[model samples]
Target: MDKPDLTRITTLLLDADGTLFPSEEPAFGASAAVTQAFADRFGLTGDFSAEHLRRTTTGKNFRTTAQDLLSRRGISVDSAELEMWVAREKEEVTSHLGEVLLPHPGVLAALRTLNRRYRLAVVSSSALTRLAACFTASGLDHLLPPADRFSAEDSLPVPTSKPDPAIYQSALARLGIEPQQAVALEDSATGVESAVSAGITTVGMVQFVPPGERGDRTAQLEQAGAVWVTESWDRLARDLADSTVVVRT
Candidate 1:
């Protein structure tokens, strides 16, 4: 597919995990460990789905909300206990976080090139701290410069997040932008839905799901109204190149 016209595009919003890094396995495994720790402390086993839904929908701090929701649902965890459990999750994830981060080859150059032409922001459900660490480890730290990132941490007291479109809208709002003039790049069905619902052009950053995984997230993303679905970073580069996008004069 031909890349979207750069002249017509303004802001660029991105999802962090699979689109910027390698695959979700490392982050997923790290997160799974955190959730397991939450369960262990709370004596709960079935809160995974609930926690996932809460994070995706509300962008709450991962462990904090997991602990809160577990307690609300009658599980035995408390804020103090959750704190210790969070420490464990944090330590474990920090040690292996670097492993999950492998940016697509030439991505730095593409980002640098695009930086000259467009404003970039991260519109992920992930905590800003972890996402910042991943970007630093992957060498995009210089380009992304953690401060520019928009994430769950930015969701504020209410924990509002994606699939509801608030996060993307927040980014554009911060930039003083209109949705029709910007684009949101995502790798998940929920994210695409959130972006499209906000009236922003959405692009699906392709990712891998294990075989026999009943549902197809790509189709779901398309249904949610993505303007493009791709696994190729080269395409993003070419899109930028085609438009000769330069920082607005």
Candidate 2:
């Protein structure tokens, strides 16, 4: 990949779930039961366990994951039923996250520094309500208010999930900037792919990942087109500071 043009970057697009906080376990854990119930109702087979759900659908909204699973089984739900399940899953997941979510260590300070010079926005595959719940629970709602948050599941005319560039494209359009003028922070392969496909340079943030698994996750993000991988938000903040300063000089 070519080097990222840090000097030109005026916006920072952040992925919320694993990037800003550790919501994957609680969020996916809450989703597993709902997913299994849906599967049982439709006779869809294979794993819908929490671990499997996290692994397969970390960067996707529950609605998209459910639809994909059903489509694979040649089963399609009408809009009403689909919307019902989506709302149920979202309610469960958001409630669970509200009780357990916490911002990653150093993230608040890192974002404080990053915000001074960059326009920061959250772009995610989650529904807007779920995203708001997470941000609110983690005390990050103030940093990214409703207007600065873009959701693939709620912000678009038709819902989509990551690995689809729609959300990133939408954020760029809303911000009135070219893709090159933004940098994306993502923690999942799908998230990285989404940003990269939108022509934004991506950095992988893996601090929330388990220590033993970070290396693998880093490689996964790199293969998905991340230009850089950082283990912590503090490090990323420092690097961006240095790079932007160097460019200015």
Task: Point out the worst 10-residue segment of candidate 2 by lDDT.
Answer: 240-249
lDDT of 1: 0.66
The superposed Cα distance between candidate 2 and the true structure at residue 103, in angstroms, equals 3.9
Measured over all alpha carbons after superposition, the RMSD of each candidate to the real structure, in angstroms, is: 4.5, 2.1
Error of 2 at 177 (Å): 0.7
| Candidate 1 to truth, TM | 0.76
Task: Indicate the residue-level lDDT of 65 in model 2.
Answer: 92
lDDT of each: 0.66, 0.90
The residue pairs in collision within model 1 are 58-159
Let me know the TM-score candidate 2 reaches against the reference structure. 0.96
